[model samples]
Target: MSENELIERIKDRNPNEPEFLQAVEEVISSVSKVLKKHPEYHQLRILERMAEPERLISFRVNWLDDEGNVQVNRGFRVQMNSALGPYKGGLRFHPSVNQSILKFLAFEQIFKNALTGLPLGGGKGGSDFNPKGKSDNEIMRFCQAFMSELFRHIGHFTDVPAGDIGVGSREIGYMFGAYKKLQNDFTGVLTGKGPKWGGSAIRPEATGYGLVYFAENMLKSVDKEIKGKSCIVSGAGNVAQFTLEKLIQLGAKPVTVSDSGGFIYDEDGIDEEKLEHIKHIKNVSRGRISEYTEKYSNAEYTEVNSDDDFNPLWQTKAECVFPCATQNEINEKDAKHLTDNKIILLAEGANMPCTAEAIDVLQESKVLYSPGKASNAGGVGVSGLEMTQNRMGVYWTREEVDEKLKGIMKRIHDDCLETVETYELSDHNYMEAANIHGFLKVAEAMKAQGVV
Candidate 1:
């Protein structure tokens, strides 16, 4: 089938889903060259099912606040294709939760899980209610209400949900409590549980650690390494902190970590003391990152807003860049600045951090740009680990789990390089390699299963 014909068929089937359509189009474009080797996929047109999900679940989450006032929020779970394994992904509970965002995440999870060589499918669930200012009791009540419905759709062997964004250990604990209450069972239906409740020890840091592992693998593809290189990482959340920790362990200096308000630049280097303080402030105390400056003079925190100048970090050259924050955080301007400084490697710790234009700029400059799916699969990959431990009624040691995760990420990195070589693409075309590698697996699965 021609590329235009495949896109038209996808649009005709999923017209209302603009985000889903765009994701499908991008994957098709990346793998169109490789599709010639597999004429069976074109004959079956498995790309159509790849465009639409098997099921989309939308429901209402009604609960009571601390004042006994009723609050209502919309909850969603898009169970994207599960051809490879059971449904697996994180549950993001932010005000930005919607059908479009969940669709894109779930769609991406399908391929992310596939790349891991795990027996897990793709699914994402979340609510639109923000847990920022809510009291503990209020958050518990809301989670209970949300899980009242979600528990019926998820299970240990079927679908497993982990923490994402606003959802953390507290939220996961509450949701798990509610699920146990509803199902009257103690199975590990959800991941990221408290250790006392069957959670993995290093689950929180898996994504960041996996990202660095993938980065190291990508660096090795060019006969280079991350040791002694300076890394600029955004987001002070789980991904950022762990990425910093791993970089520090590997003898790399990470000088930046950001939040929604702004970012901090520490030219002197981010030590363990500073990292511990940031974790306490953001995770335990739930405070802003601007307070980091109050503790250390060398570390300056500035609000990343329209008027704020971004030159401090951008102008300071770095060998590697990891955007662990939200999507679209780095645009064309940011990409140009990094490329101009001779930044050799770029990997996304968050989903789709680099915009399409920014990615284009990176490829033009021949920077090793690894997409989030391949770079940040550690989170979901470890989530799958949690599921495995749960099913076997056995938990692996932190070292054991981390070893498996590193191996998986290394394989993914090598696979990306092998894919580029097979397709005769450029050295820096990580996106194409990742997209095609992930697409071919799911596409072949869809073909074997036949059109639904």
Candidate 2:
């Protein structure tokens, strides 16, 4: 079937899964050339199989709250593809967790892992249990309960899950403990463990750091440098905090960091000292970004106005923009705002943060845009390293991990560039180039292995 025909069928079958359909559409649209060149893929229904998950497991998670009340939530695991190697991805714990969101993330992970040149494949699991207002004990109980059923399907050589969004070291510790007891084994069935355990060095900072590395390479392609470039980074989470850190290390002036409350704009630039304060505020206190203004008098915090069509944070004038927040945070109006402000570079630190309309605006404006699959692959890349370390029963120093991560990000950036050049695409279509490159790798692997 043709690309459009397949997409229509997918939409018909998944009428309520907007996010999943959007993700599949983006990839299928970008790989038209590849599909035309490799008609065998059509004969074998490669795209059809790729769009469907190998397994979708859903269960009810019941745990006790601090009040001794039983709280029930839904959980899911979408083992999308494992053609490259084992199933690998993160477990997000948020109220927004759903099959559609997890499927979209898992589908994107397939290409992202392929781009990392890692043997890891793509899968994602999570629960709708919000950890926001839950007590530590309550969160622990929920994670333990979530993993009770999850442990049956995941393992070191099977599916290796990591942390995402609300699933941090604390959550991972709880889940790993539960998995260990349930399986009666100690293995790398999970990543993002506490450093003293099996976690790799720089795992928390990998995605954000890799984003900056990718952005630097994009700037270099245009004969420009990251130094002195003003940057606006959304999301004050792990990805945003470390992205700001690496940008500072590269001599860039990152002017903003944000959270769900809103964004904080520091015109004087967020230096190392400011970054430390942010880390302490978000990572330790779990406070809002507005608290940043209380600590720094020069900075101003703005609350997100839902009534408005565009986020005021994106209206900030800057040379670089990093959307490190959740998906679809940047809409059409925000994209136009960035283009009007002449933003030169954009690298996603979050998965699919830009809406389809936002992407179109950026592409039309000739902005250098890097998709999350390539730009944010660093976190998973390091997780893949953690898997290797667990199997070897050894650990690497921080320097070694960071150096290897840098090399991997550079290779991903160069590969995207080379693909765009080879396709003779107008301007630097990194988004399309990235999709095509990663897709080809997985498609070839699937073909070689024969239809499953």
Tens digits of per-residue lDDT, candidate 1, 106-168, equal: 988888888998888888889899999999999999999999998888887778889999998
TM-score of each: 0.95, 0.99
lDDT on C-alpha atoms for all candidate structures: 0.86, 0.93
Off by over 4 Å in 2: none
Candidate 2, residues 283-351, lDDT tens digits: the string is 889888888888898999889987889899999999999999899999999999999999999999999
lDDT, residue 358, model 2: 98
Worst 10 residues of 2 by lDDT: 419-428
Q: How close is candidate 1 to the true structure, as a TM-score?
A: 0.95
Shift in Å, residue 15, candidate 2: 1.0
Candidate 2, residue 164: Cα displacement in angstroms equals 0.4
Q: Which candidate tops TM-score?
A: 2
